[model samples]
Target: MKPQHPSVRRISECFLKPDIECLPQESKQPYYLSHWDLNLLPIQYIQKGLLFRKPSEAFEDGHPFMATLLHRLKRSLSSALFHFYPLSGRLASIINEHQASILVYVDCVNTPGAKFTHAALDLTISHLLSPVDVPLVVHSLFDPDLHTAVNYDGHTLPLLSIQVTELLDGIFIGSSFNHSIGDGTSHWNFFKTWSEIFQSLPPDGDDIVSISRPPIRKRWFPDGHGPIINLPFTHSDQFKIRFKAPELRERIFHFTKESIAALKAKANAECGSEEISSFQAMSALVWRSITRARRQPQNQITICRMVANNRAKLEVPTSEDYFGNVITTLKVSAKAGEVVEGGLGWAAWKLHEAVVDNTKEKFREAVEQWFECPCTFRLDQIFVTNSLSMTSSPKFNIYGNEFGMGKAVAVRSGCANKFDGKVSSYPGYEGGGSVDLEIALFPHNMANLEADSEFMSAVSSPPHLFHQ
Candidate 1:
């Protein structure tokens, strides 16, 4: 078999804003952000995509095939923005010298609008997914300029960019969204709405699409601190950094339902308790395997900064569709030897306890502390640290997002916020509680993990799962 070199050529670029007539009066004003939203470095954007198999309709050429779909995509997305209006807004700063603080907000009045791009990939779906590892060419499917940066760029750059790349037998809808606006739930919710609208569009295209699960457009905040809160910094430039990441290799490993159950059973048997969940067991397995692969010093600390959604933990729980960032990173650390020798049960137990301890009270206390004195994130030291960050939960509905064409064939992410020791988990395409981990590591560490017998023992070869 020959290696594939995917050739991507741009067709068109445009900015799509929310329909002003459909926009509620409340959304027309400056939308303030929560501390949960502002806590992240403004430069980071969540870049991911969904691949849809080619439609059943026949066409003489690829250009006309795309030309037909583009009309429908634009209409549905514009309708999606009507509910997710804040995504089209720009990030603005308001400095108050007397208060000695700066306020960051979504400047709805001056929205640059979301960037929409159409492109052609001279390749087939099989050619795209033939590799054991995620192909590097997949990154080119997105707008490259919006990678890891402080969200402050929203002042000028489009806050969201959706690139539609048409392949021979499939189409990949890649989106670059600023992290300042929301988390994984918010990101997927936008896509879910867009797909639903696309499927529901009437032939005439005259009626406004009614939202079945309308987004909770209002942002979340603790009492008295917001609807509007000021950051400790006076200038946005203080958050900027020349973030240079090490060249890391990315590969995905698939865990079957049987394998996940086996891992959970093993961890529970070792702990003599059934409290260990499948997620914990699988995460622990990765942590231990990666620690061994890195060959960190026996006495050195190994931490898994597990990212958890804080939506349900809030004192006054908001709806699941809350349209903002509500998340926290909890750490579970142990000596490298302990993590390796303690067996999967011990590591999993630690993770389960940390998750249980992240109560709403704990989250609120952390927020209040941030209110006293704020600190921004610096991405330069991410790869240098001896810690690993687990992002994207398998619970997210990655496989269920269906446009008029069909449900996604495979989900892929871009090269943003990517560094050594970054493990992103997604539910397998086949469903039934299977898991797929998109893992990244330095070249040598990745090689060691690829060859690690214990890690490879539970991973299964994937099947051909894509369809129209």
Candidate 2:
């Protein structure tokens, strides 16, 4: 093993006295939980990989690397909050009440001699799951004891008792995290930071740069807010739904930067309007896809809600990298049939109008007003569009999320079980040339969606998009 870097040592020491003040405070209202407080639970799941013969041989000296990794983990674990530590009885209680709290275990099988590589892990996980629960933690309340872990089967290093099956030899690091901590980006940032520290590398200097503070105690509802309606849980009755499917429930698609530019030009030409954004273009594609899947009439007023982070727009500087939710939702409604009939360019223009047209202040005001009342509002679907630049090695290093093994293949937001649909976008594979989209819809809806030719063609076409 290599010596721990000076900076890495400093980071390990810092966790020993983690600044609680750095974490956001929970509001007093019954349901007004801070993103930090809600996502504090840590659920553990495992990621497995294979080790090469040479690397295995190099570790012939009795499990020394395992000991060192454990030592560092113990030190770091001691520094952070112990709230996520599962109480034997409490864990059972949660399992009984919210059966959905069951953790998801993902296995990444690699060929032997396959050293653990960051890019491979990213691709594997990206192809497997979206960061579903990570994003939900921003808005939902969570108990502690949420985490994921990985278990290794074969190895030359005796980290743990290596139990081999007929197939592969590799490492499994259990990933445990509280959903309420932060968005997928924030969680990935933490994992990347941990990995860098483990590898004895300097943490990215700009990674921890400060952003605006979030408004802590604003009244969400000043005047009397009224008639909050809770939508029925369409698929809640079927709790046995599998996490991944032979065919995905929702398809993820992307458009290249150039493609988006071309779409905008086409939209302008057709609608006699100004240029639109990539987000709008993508949204238009999805809206059309959904309508085609549902075969709904043109007059149906379908709604598309876009999720926007309000950290920068707030009066105070929000903790940009803070672990909890700091987002507000905005809705755009159009006749479903009209959108599909009007063509992708028209729908894209509508989406653009809904997004860029809104003032920053309007978003702030909407957030303030939401908290003014105690109403629990729900929506049909949400779309999260962000730059993939976030996951780049220099910008954010998820590969460094070392729990003993190496980094994760994919880190995604929680599945959208609460609503009719959920969608998220990450940076495209190569640079910022394109984007990767993940969509989650009700299972039945997903089945209907997969059979649609138009939707399938769009997904399989030039840019390429599909459900994970």
Maximum-lDDT candidate: 1
Clashes of 2: 60
Error of 1 at 48 (Å): 0.9
lDDT of model 2 at residue 110? 16
As a whole number from 0 to 100, the lDDT of residue 175 in candidate 2 is 31
Per-candidate TM vs. native? Answer: 0.96, 0.53
- 1-468 in candidate 2: lDDT tens per residue? 632211100111111222333333321112223322222222111111121111243256575754454455433332222111110001101122343332211111111111111111112222133332222221111111111111111111111111111101223233323232234444454444444444542233312222122222321222343112111222222221212212224444545666656655766777777767556666676677766666667676777766555556645555545444455445677787777789877877777777675667786566555444312221111222210111111124333345544323333332222233555565543335455565655566666667766555544332211221
What is the C-alpha local distance difference test score of candidate 1?
0.84
Cα lDDT tens digits, model 1, 380-452, are 6444467788899888888877776777778899988888898898999889898889998988999999999
lDDT of each: 0.84, 0.37
**RMSD in angstroms, candidate 1?**
2.0
Give stretches of model 1 more than 4 Å off: 1-6, 58-64, 381-384, 466-468
Clashes per model (N, Cα, C within 3 A): 5, 60
- Candidate 2 local accuracy as lDDT? 0.37
